[model samples]
Target: MSTIGSEGWTLVHQARQKHYDDRYYGHWLGTRDDGQWIIGRLYPGKSMDDGFRDGEWAYSKRFAGDPSTDNADAALTAYVEMAHNTFVWDRVFDQTVGEAIDLYWAGPEVPDAPKLAAGWAGAESPNPDRVVSSAGCSIAMPLHEAKFLLLHYLRRTELAAKAHLTKGVTVDRHGAVEKVRCATGPIRFEYGYNTYWLT
Candidate 1:
């Protein structure tokens, strides 16, 4: 089920802030439909010695839409994998920090099966669910900031996708965002079930 409740999202933010300077990676707690919490993180901008970095868009998609909550995470994860492999990650290396940031936030290639990647087909289009999500992301940041950023993004994306969401929908915090192809792979992230709220 979608994370319509607002509780537990802020803890995700706090964790990200805690690791802002000294650490390049961090984790947060999110929930499933049953109210089980999952471990998630923000987009780790740099590739740490521990291999902590992944594309920002990928992190957001996974953190918010993980399927294990109901075994329905495939559609979102598959699309994210394709988008990252298709339009996100870059091959250029040895660039300065600024240059790297530019690359991460750069516009993606027209995703394969563009209609498939889109959240919904637009009213003007032949298919109301076929329209690609025009909104993309900005420069990469730490996990703390990344999760919060995604909350705003989720607000935007949900609004853009449904044009009716006012504020309850959330991008979720922690959990293993399993790639659709990795049916047998181990869990990507693991954490305790803790929820944080604004109040």
Candidate 2:
């Protein structure tokens, strides 16, 4: 496990062929598509401060996209900053990542809920240092995030996002994106939350 940024967030990574039975051994965390710099977090809920909970990998929301920069380090910086910025810090962190995750998760702290975007449409924020917010309440992304998500969805075969997308399906004036249609389905502005689709 490598450390990310100046922040205490750990980078949990393993090769595709590498798998361990150990619980803390880690999984395929996320990816930074080089060149296009499509940055995305595979696990939305994973908390940098809490490590892993019970059977959970993450508990936060963030986004993805194409190569925004040619530099790997700069691209990485963008991804981590976005993740740290967009989640409710008080929920998992009463203190900070410098403390222990196990203690944080087992404590008597109240669960901090994610806020709804203005107009009650989508997601709003996280408190670390947000890079960008996308898809209203869905997820946040880096520079090339939009293009990345569009391509990511389009690459799939299950949904015909290219054909079904219509204004009637997207987020209304209130900001809530209910049932929209697309080829790649809903593009996650954040990991677990679906915000935008190809229209």
What TM-score would candidate 2 get against the native?
A: 0.17
Please, what are the lDDT tens digits per residue for candidate 1 over residues 90-195?
3421122122222222222332311111111223223576654353444434332333333333323333444223123322322211121111211121111111
- By summed lDDT, the worst window of 10 consecutive residues in model 1 runs over 190-199
Task: Give all TM-scores, in the order shown.
Answer: 0.21, 0.17
For all the candidates, what are their Cα RMSDs to the real structure?
Answer: 18.0, 17.9
Q: Write the per-residue lDDT of candidate 2 for residues 1-199, one digit (tens) a residue.
A: 3434332343433211111332222122232322222233333322333343432343332233422222332433454444444332234332222122212111232234222111111233233453233322225333133333333332231132222233454333112211211112223332222234422
After superposition, candidate 2 runs with Cα above 4 Å error: 1-4, 7-23, 28-152, 157-199
Q: Show model 1 residue runs off by greater than 4 Å.
A: 1-133, 163-199
Measured on C-alpha atoms, candidate 1 has an lDDT of 0.29
> What's the C-alpha lDDT at position 35 in model 1?
27
